[model samples]
Structure formats: C-alpha cells, structure tokens
Target: MRDRAEITIVGAGPAGLTCAIGLALAGKKVVVREWHGDVGHRFHDDLQGLENWTDPVDVLDELAAIGIAARFDHHGVSEGVVFDGQAKPHRVRGKRPLFYLLRRGNAIGSLDRALLDQAVKAGVEVRFNDRVTETAGDMILAAGPRRADIIAAGRVFDTDMEDGAWLAIGSELAPKGYAYLLTHNGRGTVASCMFSGFRDQASHVAATLAFFERHAGLRMQNPRPFGGFGNIRLPRTAMQGECPVVGEHAGFQDALAGFGLRYAVRSGRLAAESLINSTSYTDAWRRALQPGLRTGVVNRFLFNAAGQSGLDWLIERLARNEAGDTLAQAYRPSLPKRVLFPLAHHRFRAPLIDPSCNHENCDCVWCEHGDHSAAIAGA
Candidate 1:
C-alpha cells in the first residue's frame, strides 16, 4: 500500500471497487485494501448461487461510466410469479428486467477484473489480504456487516433467504424473492433465492422443493440445496466527520427490499463526485438517494402498520406483477411534494418525540424541573 494517497478505500466489494474505479478515472491517486487475499474466491465454488440477479439498466449505465459492464450469456425474465398460499399464482411483468440469476463467481470475477484493470491503467494502487486496523483522513468504509466494530466505536448511535430448484415449481415455493436452478455450461444446477425475513426459512425451502417435485412430476433421489442472505439498511445519519460514507456503510440499503446493487453503484459515483469537486458530502448523498429514501420510509410505515402478511399482499400485487414498473413509476424523479412530505413527516418524528417519556430527568429542556428553587439556583 502507498504510504500516503489521495484516497484509501476499504473493502473491495461492489461499492468500494466502483468508488476506486471512479476516483482513479478522475485522475486521483487511489489505494484499495481487501482483507481477502484473492478477489472473487469466496464465490468461486458457488457459481450459480444467486436467484433473480436482474441488472437494472441504470446500474449498467453507471458501470459503463466507470468502464465496467456486466457480461451475461443468458437473457433475464421480465415477469416474476408469486405464490401467496391462496388462489391462483400472480405474475408480474414490466419493462425492467425483474431479476437475473447468474453464477456469483462470474459477476464477481467480471467486476474484480474490470475494477483492477481500470485502476492499474489509471495508476491506482491496490492492496489485497491487508485488513484495515485503523482509519483516518478521507477513508471510506464499505465493509458491510463487518463494520459492526467501527460502528460500536462511534458515539452517535441511531441504530438501526433460500429457495430451490425446479424452474416453475421451485419459483412458487419461495416467497417474495425469486428462485433459480441454473446449470453452468451444462455442469450442475445451483438453486437459491432471497428469503425476505420469512419466519421459517427452512419451511420455505421445503415448500419450494415440494413444489418442484409436484409441478415437474420428477424427483432426483436427493436434490442439492444451497442458500444465502442479502440485506438493506435503513437511512442513517452521517458518521463523526466530513468524509462521506457510501454503499451499505452509509445505510443506503432498502430495508423493505434487499435490492442494493443499483443503490451501491449510484452512491459510489456520488461519493467520487463529492470528493473530486469538493462538494458537501451530506448534500450530495441526500441528492443521490432521496427517491429510494422516500420509498424506504413508506415501506417501513406500511410494514409497521400491516406486518409481513400485509407486505406480502402489497408486494405480490404491486411489485411482482408489472415486473417492477409500478415501483419504477412510483420512484420517478419528480415525486409530488404532497406524497413526499408525509414520508418526511415519518422520518423526522423520532427526533421530535420527547425522550423524557422513556426516562425521568431527560436532558431535554421540555422536561419539567423537579424543584423550582433548585432550577433557579442552577440557572
């Protein structure tokens, strides 16, 4: 690693790698460090692990801006089917690609090679197998759950899937997310899905297998099962300083939906721009993700009001069928002030609540002073 660089990014995931590529493209000296020695190693063994790996066109555009684009041999389905345990299954179709499933290794390998190649071409230094023990200056932390320690060390603390295998039947078995069984170059099939916090993940897995067996009317003695988890974080305040945090580190994930790759790419570009142009990081972040944040607030409200069943109903009805066109329309850049004001109301209420209600002698001035004479004396 260079002793001193204009920027040092930790974690070589999509977010960090994208940022590094963007910054280097802008002619800034950059160094990136990853704890893992080899890029895309963890995913090498599980090539066909992801289900519904849809590539949003906007994400592709952003990647292209940084000189990296996803290469997939298969076309993605725009329609997704949802089984709600009642009535006929629902199908959602839209203009956007619903979700695309690919081998994790392929996605990671393409991105890793693209990022490193661009960084080297642009004269950016990269360090692998080097864990960041300490951070200072303009450092970006995109370590995801691994950053739990860094979060704990800070003072301001506003805290905070599986499926299987038959093509049609297995898809029905999984809830909310997509299920896929893909054979890589005619080798073997890898089946998986996104769980969406279902109460019984194992049961969902079993149900998917059963659906495959019943629908396909065929069964191997023992079908292989593989599963994994994806996540999105709530909107959170900026950390201790002026340096901007991007991607999962800054809580840009949609808590309602686990789709974060688009957001990650957008946020990474926004951060790079902020650094290069010397713009206010907070302003840039807000401008970058305002729509998603608004949507997230609405999602949280609905989830709290109706719970999973309600969410399932809405998602099945709205999100799945029109593909994600309804969502795309809802998330348009020109969101009505009337619609957004309510979401702002929801997001701002926590700071407005009186802490004294939860604990006596709260520091808030609204709390009544117990003794008038003592209060006057102290004043």
Candidate 2:
C-alpha cells in the first residue's frame, strides 16, 4: 500500500508514535508503519523502568509537560537492595522515588500501547505489519536499538514476592553490566545484562538465578525465558539523508544504567518540533541531550574498564553516604563536573577508538568526535 503524508515515521515505538502525535496535533498528516502486529510487540513480559535523577523534574511530569497524556500508572520505586557480589546486601533508600517501573508488552496498559492510543486520538494514522524499506516526504526513523552493545537474557515468572527491586553486580552474574530482579503484584522479571561475557551467557543467567534465589528469596513458578539487545552509542548526525533517527537508534540511552524511555520521549518530541518549526534536529538534540549522553558513554567506559573490583569500589564509595544522595549525584547528568572537566583531565577515554562504525547504528567515533579517527572518517 503506497501513500503520502506530510511526515512518514518508521517503527511505531515510543519515539515514532510520539512524533506522530505531535505532528498530527499541529495539523500535519502523519503516517506510521510498524513491522509488528501491534504496539510493544517487540517485548514480552519485560519490566522496564525510567530514571528520575538525571532530570530536574520527574519523568512522568516531563512527559506531561510535552503534552503526552498517556493513561498509564508509573509505579514509584523508592528503595532497593544492591549487592557487589560479596558485601552484605547494601540497602539504598531515597527520600523520593528514584525511578518508576512499567511493563513492556502489547497489553492495554503497557507504555507503548498507551502512546499508541494518544497518537490515534491526535489523528495519526497507523499501519500495522506494514514494514517499510523506503519512504518519501520528511521522514522520522524511530526504529528501536540498532546493534547489541549489551545482550540481555530475561525471564518472566509468577512469583510470591511483595513488590520490590533488587540489583546484583558480580563477574559470575553479569560481566560488565548488572543483573536485576523486579517484582510487582505477584509477577516478576529477572534478567542478566552482559557487557563482555557473551560466550558464557547461559552460565551467567543460571548463576544469576541461583544468586537471587539464595539472596533475594525469590519464589516463582512457570518461568519463561526471553532475550533482547541494548545499544548505547551516540549518533554522529541526527539526519540520515534528510531523515532524523529517534529513540535508542540515536544512542539516547543512559550509559550508567540502561534507562532510556525518557530519552526516547524527549527525542521524539524534539524531532517533531524541528519538522514543524523548520529547525535543525541535530542542533536541537545536541543542545538538550548531547551533554548527558556523552557523559553516559564515558561512565560506561570507566565502569567496563574497572571490571568487578572497580565496580565494587565505586559502589562502596557511594555507600559512604547514608542517604544514597552521593549515588544519585554520581548518576545524574552534570555537564561541568561529571563531563567537561573530567574528560579534559582524563584525556576523554572511551570504549571504542575507531571513528568508523556501521552507519546504520550511528555509534561511531565520527558521531561523538571521540578521538583522532573522526578527523578523517565522516558519518
């Protein structure tokens, strides 16, 4: 089915749908093409959450400020237990909600489904199972993550838990990333995100299960296994031949933790604003999000390099403060302290040195201007 509109968005995820809604409300005809049957089809019973410390305001409030009135409950998470593979369970508690949890599925209440509803209400036309390779008119590529920087093995199960979250860090469970168990309303999702140890993934998953069982006292039945990939590289250019990429495809993910829903929503709205106001998408995103994202990449590199011992050291350092305030400050996006001067002092270290990367993924040296390679390589 061939059609034309003022704007054509690919992949009906948070970013694409948000863009559609914004453009539609502005009286522009918008069409969205989805490869899957419905919204949130890419995920199963995965329990995802958005970070709150980075932004000055709450994530839900930020969404509301952008006129996104999705009717979904944001489960506030105020406290959690962290384990550094050995130390007695370190309990971190905050005065306010540290994050908000949501399910990832096509259910009526899922975040993706909620966004779709809002988009439709704004007169955005959505075509399901209409995988598109090429398109005409102003284009927005809101496709999900591009490459697998960290592969996650997840499981959804019926558990007798009383609603809580637990994060564990150790070489045996997850190499560079962390393993988390989130339970709510008698259901739970447990996953091991691996950064370097891809070959021993199964073993890592098994070890995570065992560790949680012993430490968290997790009781479950009928555990179903699933997996997905996460990409955390920044894009060199926001435009691909006049098309702007949004969501995780633009590397708008948090480097310290894999929280990106806020970034997805923010980028989508920014993309739509650019299209309507005849502004530069790249400049807009750079002004709003580039600093935080670049800081995240540096944090990711340092965390990976530190390995298990370094991770333990960092956590212990955070534990020095009783109220978990230091930890929050460490994770929050601070341009002057965390990024600029730190990078200048340390010579701007990164995980990848080469400027050339697959253009589709956009996590290249050219995109971030990381080092020497970007001088010759163009994105």
Candidate 3:
C-alpha cells in the first residue's frame, strides 16, 4: 500500500516542527499532525525558569534555517551566583557578560510559524488539532513522553518537581542539578526543581521555600500558582528499527541538566535530512550527535555521584574564576585527542571498577576461578 504522505511527523514540539520545515525545504511531501488545538499553546504563559543557557549561536543558526531568526533576543548577564547546601555562596562572572535566555513560547511560536509557512509553500500538508493514533509510512515520532507507546516499552525515570527560580533556597534538597527561580516579564516568580528525584521532591520544595525565606526574606505564603512539568530523556536504543525518532521522542533531553532546546532542534533537522535523502537512521543519529551524546553520558554519571554534595562541589568549582573556564572547556567535545583521552579515562574508568574483589565466596567467576587458576599455575 502506498503511504498517504512521503513523511508523516507526529508532534509539534521543536523537533517535529524543525523536521517538518527541513523536509519541506528539501521538497519532500511532509505532513505534520499536531494534537493541540493551536500551535505553541503548550507553553503559552509562565515560562519563568533559569535562563543560564549555552550555545546561543547554534540556536540562532537553527532558527535561521527554519526562517524564524528574528524572534531571538539575547540577555546579557555579568555573573551567576552558586549556592551549595552548606557552603558560602560563590559568585562567578563572565568576561563577555553575555548568555542566552528566551521565552520558550517565543521560540516555539517562531518555529511553528516558519514550519507551517514553508510546508505550505512546498505543497506539504499540515494538520492541527488532529491526533495521530498510529503511524504508517516513514513515521517520525517527536511526541515527547507519548512516543513511548509507539516504540518498544522502556522504563521511565520520574523526578516530579517543579522547575523555576523559587528553588534556590535549600536547592540541596533536590538531587544533583541546580534549581531555578525565574520571572517572565515581571508577572510572577516560577520555582523549579531541575533534576531532583521524586523521593526527595517534597523536601526539595520545602527547602527551596526555606532558602527563599532566609535569603530574600520574603514570606509570600501563597502556594505557587504554577505546577511542575518534567522533560524526559529517552534511551538512544529506542530508535532501533526502520523509522527514525526525533526531538524529545528519541530522548534527546539531557537527563542531568534538563536543557534540550538546541538538541531537539538539531536532532530534528538531522532526522529530516536523513528521511529526505534515504540515509540510515543510525548514521543520521551519530552524525547529528557525534560529540554531544558522549559527553552527556559522562556528565550524567557525575551528576548521579555522591548524592547532591558532589553536585555542590561541581557547581562551586565552576563558580571559581579559573575552575569555571576549565570546567566549561572540559564540557566541550572538540578538545584534542591528547586532552580528551585522559579526561575520558578519569571520568569513566573509576566507575568501571568492581568493589567485590576482596569478598570470598562471591559469585564473580573472574575473581574466583580465573584468579585461582592463575595462582595454581604459578605453583
């Protein structure tokens, strides 16, 4: 049976929209089906969260590629304060005094408009308020959490905490990552827990409130008006078969950091290019995320280490003038092989060691049989 469209994309997030636009630009017949009544409505209001973003240039390039380059506005910040659970706060400023912050809605709106326009111009069809119950031909799933149903079932690691600025107080109450307190256009503050676990979620919230009380000394006793929503990280293995998955559907979100805007856009473009050119999905995945995904694994391992204390150490280290640049440089994957190999060894090797070497009667065959055989041969 012939497919209805050459490509069918489900979802209208950054990934889906970008894919639609890219494919349309390639002159492929594409149909973007969005379940929502209106585009960009999911995050229409209350986008207050931490805006300490990296990769502004890449984001701009993606926007330009999709024809929405004008919507971006860069916010300059002189310094960012780091607060560990018990340590004194450390302040770190950048030499350039510039970083990127944007309203999520604005970015989504721009992409949505540009994608819809391009799709129409290229004679592609777009269906809004239409839910795709199933996918047939060259399906691209970018539906975030819902994509789980379309693919093989995978475990979901949930950390149910809000993401916003009010989380500064007792930010230690969460897991490893930072808490954010942000206000959009002076409407109201949004308190958030970026990467705390569900088990510690309530404690994180209380500690956040306490932190605000102690530092800001403001007792706004009203409950937070906004609820929390989490972005999930899908396993890379989820895209194992014929069709390709893009955006959050493929689990491109950084599990440790919860920053996925750029990743989603980039991955979407890659997926679109692969589909249009008849390239392999796995090759597209690797080419699109050759370096970022590897580093993300290392960082996620660090975030899961030593409770939240280790995270505090990392944050404090970054707040120091010298250490911040070093840490930031370390995160970059473009480092020379001489520098990269040692860092990779340091980050990944120690975790690979087994602690049960000394335990007798343990089930580890290598320690028991292999070691004993070698010792007996020496006799």
Compute the lDDT for candidate 2. Answer: 0.74
- Summarize candidate 1's per-residue lDDT along 116-135 as a digit string, tens digits: 56566767677887877566
Query: Candidate 3 residues 65-139, lDDT tens each?
Result: 665444333444445455666635666665543234444442443444545555567666778788766556677
**TM-score, per-candidate, Cα-based:** 0.66, 0.86, 0.68
Model 3: CA > 4 A from native:
1-6, 40-44, 48-58, 72-78, 95-99, 105-124, 146-172, 194-203, 216-224, 228-241, 306-310, 322-327, 334-379
What is the descending TM-score order? 2, 3, 1
Decoy 1 TM-score against native: 0.66
Q: Which ten-residue region of model 3 has the weakest summed lDDT?
A: 147-156
Quality of model 1 by C-alpha lDDT: 0.49
lDDT of candidate 2 over 191-280, digit per residue (tens): 887765555667888888988999999787889986766667667786777788888767677766777888898899999899888888
The global Cα lDDT (0 to 1) of model 3 is 0.51
Worst 10 residues of 2 by lDDT: 370-379
Note each model's CA RMSD in angstroms: 12.2, 6.5, 12.2
**RMSD value for candidate 2:** 6.5
